[model samples]
Target chain A: MYESNRKSSIVNIYLGSMKIAYVLPMTWACGGISAPLSQVNALSTRGHDITVFAPKDGRIDWFPLAAPVQVHCEHPVEEYFDAVVYVGDTFAQHPFSSAGQKFLLLQGKDHLWTAPAKRNELLQGYSDPQYHILVVSGWLADFVHGKCGNPRISIIGNGIDINRFFPAPAPREKFRLLLEGNFPDRNKNVIAAIEIAGRVRQHFPVEVWAMARRFTSAGELVDRVFLDPPSDEIPGIYQQCDALIKTSILEGFGLPHLEAMACGCIPITYASGGVMDFCKHGENSLIAGVGNLPSLLGHVLHFLSDSDLRSQLKDGALATAKLYPWNRVADALERAFAGGIEGKS
Target chain B: MRILAFTRESYPSNYPTSYILMHQSMALEELGHEVHYYQQDKHPLGLTDYLNSFSFDLIFLDLEFLRSNPLLRILSQYRRIEPIHIVGALYSLPAPPGPAWEVVDFTITPWKGETTSGLAAQFDLRYLPLAYSDRLHKRQSASAGSIFVGNTTGNKHKEAGVYLDELIGERSVFCIGPEFTEKYMDPFMLGSLYASSRCLPNFHYSWEKSGDCILNERFWQTARCGIPVNDYSPLMDEVFETGLLEHFCFADTRIWQNRIRNLNSGAETVHPALIQKLDDSLKEHSYKDRMKQLLDWLR
Candidate 1:
């Protein structure tokens, strides 16, 4: 009976030709914007009319309409969309106050214990059974459930484009390393990696390359550090790198780790946040204690001295990256839509 | 007048809130008031502790601590001796209760105007705008940007590092806070270096949460130094209406990109006219004057 009910609900959505709207905080080159765009691409292919309500930006590549995706600038929510996906924090007062199915694709907890007004808004939004909240990591999911009191939560890990990042030729005699993202981010912990590199230089010749909008003095220690003007040559950079060191203090999900892994770069990350979800401590990548300067330095030294260990981590990281393809994430999102339709009926 | 102020302990490396509170207490003392600051943890357990130290002309309670414990009920007993005032931004706590809400006399928040008005109504407490000490004013006039403070950790919402990254892209942005370790040193110092070359020096509070916009000393310091801050709050308009301080919507990368591009185009320099307008506005809404106005309501 449940299966039959689910089938009818999906049929109702299809027969009614329900339109889904995704409200994304349109930004350039950030994980929040890219993740949603990728999901939209995948979902649009599955025949759902997906309209992305985001801030207008010139940098983002416009999605093809043939794939059932439409990008609209954020505006009043007067027009009815079957499902509304909020990518980030919802404004205190939504202009188009409507009783529609709301989906929160939470990246992290921003105003969780502070910002009372925002918390209240999220509480109200979550209480509505029609709302389906999805968090990127288990820690964030637990936080949403504990703080927002929303029991109905899902964990949809972020995905990477495997084709963009593929294995490179064997590393040269000197180990080439790369780190990406907003460099100053405390969670990224690029400084720790640099410190570890300094210590590792005792053993092997190490060249660190950082690709970010900015770089720090420690990042300057690298052979080459590229700033904000992100190059299209990123794939080549990843391939050349022997390993990607992530020493972030905290993360909702480590996207760069996955990206680097996809490029066949060994990942050595501090064991915290969502890194544990993807990387097994010894299997896929080297997981060190967060802020353990000595251990991290030791791990870097180990990777530098032992080529066999680096090779193992590289292969494992590549294997782990395969499990989280964009297509699979898109399929999971489609399944969520199907579940939402089922509940409506 | 003896004033008993209750708040969190001063962790030297903590945000300006604790430092601001201490500085404000000292300023209040300069105005012929004896200020006694008490951390929530220092309060002795049981009824005897309260009866012994409940006498004061004015009692300033940090509402953040009161909400977590039954201290408000205990404090209500001494309402006659001390008129309780709750100060601090209301973090993640539930809406104030109806009957219990009357215990608080004044609610000092970082928010301004309507946001403050709305919050005051919700808690049934009188609202007072935040005050900046004279020390901060002195710091503001200093042209050199030697200190690069970034939020390396603690609060996630502030996204201070994110802003620093944009401002200090390829430039050095400095990270200063309790959470700063060797790990964050690379990105933090790099941001500092990048910002150092530019006219504006980059500094971030790596440990503290974002402050509400009430044109406090920090905002002035950033503006007076000709450093544009990528403020996330709407209250920034109320504080700096003349556009002296560059503001960017937190999630809007285009705004960041445009600002960077403008900076590259040599439009990054702060105009004297804009600085004059900001200074003039701040003088008009001086903390002392605002405090006097609030004190009048109490009278």
Candidate 2:
């Protein structure tokens, strides 16, 4: 979910990797877990001793980590970490403030929260201005430090693996559309994507696929519903589809766009939130009018009809995906960590 | 002769200079010379009061950076009468032989080329090859694998990477650096690491590979620990011209593996007579002997 951010290089004689602790909300299946995992994997490989505290659930066995993130489940992690990054609500809920230079990571504000006071309370905690505040996108950073009046903030954008996802070598479904993310989430608007696919299917020889932990294809107008898919299965899914649909009401940073782009899947969305940072209309992706159902369906049909536009959009999407590798994100995080240590944050 | 050894206060575990100072002081002490160590920026004693405690004949200064003029100011206090000062530099040369060397009578250097050449022509230069410390003693005991020791992250470790690439996870190589091992190993454990190791691989912190490169003091520590060294430099062959170098120094990784396997299988043991010859040669590079040579050069 990271958007536009970062670059700085620090060289010194002391070259030991600092011990780090990543505080995650849960080790359970969540779309948000992917963002932190990308950075965790990158930092761990760079030789930092990474201890991941996913206390509420079982050890995260799905994501590939360079070194096994010592999951603190049975007991508390005793070793002193140089930095402990509490992702989103984990900072408020967890008890690791006295451990090290505490950092609060906000992926992006979720629209699901209706209670205005509670949302302000969470933002107030993130904007304490004492410790470092890391956001996923430029827009979220602006919203936090600008609108919310938080003095300390650093933009560490989300990353997608460029090598893992690529243009469909031999696309299994030529005109098929795939919707990624949990179906039950109201913000994701899975029903809208499913209905749009049904409208396209009426005229064109096209099928719709929905990927989630648990979603039924029977009544949902989708041809297939991939349930709790393995990590390897993701790239293949992205490659097979001609387009990936994101009908989210609000997003901190749209991770699916880059992910889909990497797989050469052209993203069709109503340019909103962090999506605006990457998705340029008629450039990297096709942007439809926000809340305008006609423009959204027209863009989907436009992709289905035109071969030249799809190829051009695919190339642009592929190029956009390469810009945000995990390595770059990790470097920016390291700089933020350094700045926090020096009290510059 | 009464010698006042001055070095900036440093923990032996943190700084290599402090570690080297231990041996350098021991060498002077071993020669029946009185060596009193005074750590600058460490003690409460004033510079004049520190010098007043003893009538020093010569003062040994380990030149890291000439920041505080503690000694210079002390010498200036007794401008009419002052002991000669000898300064030693390693890793980096005190470039341009700057104004820092103005007060220094003699300068000791490690290698022969550009690292010392410019300064040698500028000052009274003495060659003190990196040596085995007085605290270390040879042990026949050894462990299972080849090992390396250094600060892992900050070091220019291209050779270690190359060595790892060549070994390809085949050889049981123990990497003892800041991350892998304790921050720093004590002399006893460090010696045991050398004693127990079969193939002792090391790299120069300096990447000037083709030039006249002398390795870190750890290079001598491994030799003193009584293990065969796998230094990837021609300097070893040039220095240990004794035919025993052929038996000990290995150039290729495949050949090193073949020999290590032979030693492991009891087909061959590192020749004790060769070890004796090397041990006899070690004295020449020993701090005591190097100090003796320096004194002889002065005479």
Candidate 3:
């Protein structure tokens, strides 16, 4: 009697007209909110009903969030959604109904995982059969699996808005290094970044672009610094820069690296966290051991002195960025929605 | 008191925290207490052997050592008689005790606030503020400009160093720590340098991260050498009540500037009463007194 299913494609990977709900924060500056918001738009175009539950009623101009992806505080539980994606640590607290595949989208580790009541309890949430983890990087997936009680996890490269970010002409008398992050956060490793920048500046005469959150002075080490810039200005800033230098020991997905990569800027970062997925060692980006000033200096100096290597890496980085459009992310989500339902049933 | 002191750092002390521990051990001995020190770098197994073998009147556990052992960890299993166990460390610590807190009799920390001590009541927490040893109390023949000793690799630290430079004006400020030189100095060597500087200066990066705000080992080192400190820190309010404004604690940066200007003009300001206060503080806040208080509680 099931022979009638012969009309279906080779594999029924596509979830036809599935209803999905994403619970996220309305934060303007948060990378966690922006990454998912970009994907939700792609999913909406693919004919999936997307509802985003957020407490805020209004919207900011820069975020590129529009139609089909509904943002409301009220739960659409009465509609019986097929899949539920809880965004980061804050939204992961929302309750899941007896039905639907629950996925916890973790954008970073360390700070988010340890800040809560206990670490073991968070791991147990991932281990639960009712829930599956959706992280953007292999490093994060491995990190979560090792910590959690269960090995239920998946890695989908966080898609980029390829249209908004691209290479632009700018002054490059000395190689421009971009460092963007909240200065107060310990996880950002702000002090270590400044030290790494200083080591490079003394030898190479490099200019540092520090978009430091709540900062007064760039100090003698950093060449240029700004307190706040509009979110849209980030892509242009990345385009004009030669490289993105970071020192964070723990990261879920280093978003700035991805944004900079789209604009043809090479990244020199710690071989830690999700960003390692795109910023492959010696191929598209330079890698260094976390908190090792000497090793970081070696990479920065190599990038500054070598022009042919920078051009080669810049081409490699741009090619890597092109591979991750929001549509590709939506395709992965469709597979997860279909497979998860089959497993649960 | 028959005390056993433990450390995770080198025994001779190459860093600030270890210097505090080494000085604390020497002070206990100076108070006529028989003390034996075992450091992890050299004597890891010897410490374990002693733990399983000896019967002591009191045990002083470093925060690092208490968390080192896993299988043969707890003191109750090795000892025939109960020793007054105290766990303390010079590192920046939070209020709630760690895994070993329930097993210990008391916790010795530098953080002095109602909230921290209140939360640590179950472990009978003792507030032993950071103090310089009696060995560093000698006055120098000729003292000059300030000396800054702390990390400088950090942006905040570098910024603070620059701020100190502005306050000191044309006068010399010798900064002999990270970014200056890598060579490690013991307490005696560090003390000799402390005595030469007219004022020992430090600045706060974040009060939340710092233990007890301003009650650092720098304050004790300055007082012992009869030097003035230039900074606004509320933690000194506990010890210097009456002379909070005049006696070494400068609330205003401008006032600190004027004081340094006056010092450069050649007028010695170390009053006899202030000298007496430093001596009294050295005796009152010694690790010897801290141990005695815990022992009394244990009895």
Candidate with the greatest TM-score versus the true structure = 3
Point out the worst 10-residue segment of candidate 3 chain A by lDDT: A1-10
DockQ of 1: 0.01
**Model 2, B1-299: lDDT tens per residue?**
76666655422445666566666655665565645555556433455644543345776665544434655555645534654545545444434335456656666767667657766776766667677765554656676667667643433356556555444356555666665534546543566567877656554644545455665677677777765655456567655664767776676766765665566445777777787776765666777777888777666
What local distance difference test score does each model get? 0.56, 0.67, 0.63
Off by over 4 Å in 3: A1-11, A57-60, A68-76, A90-93, A96-99, A110-121, A212-217, A226-228, B1-299
Model with the higher TM-score, candidate 1 or 3: 3
2 against 3, candidate with superior lDDT: 2
**What is the Cα-based lDDT of residue A221 in candidate 3?**
78
Question: Can you rank all candidates by lDDT, best first?
Answer: 2, 3, 1
**Cα lDDT for residue B58, model 2?**
74
Query: In terms of docking quality, how is candidate 3 classified?
Result: incorrect
- What TM-score quantifies how close candidate 1 is to the native fold? 0.49
How do the predictions measure up, each by TM-score? Answer: 0.49, 0.50, 0.53
Clashes of each: 25, 4, 1
Better model by lDDT, 1 or 2?
A: 2
Using DockQ, rank the candidates from best to worst. Answer: 3, 1, 2
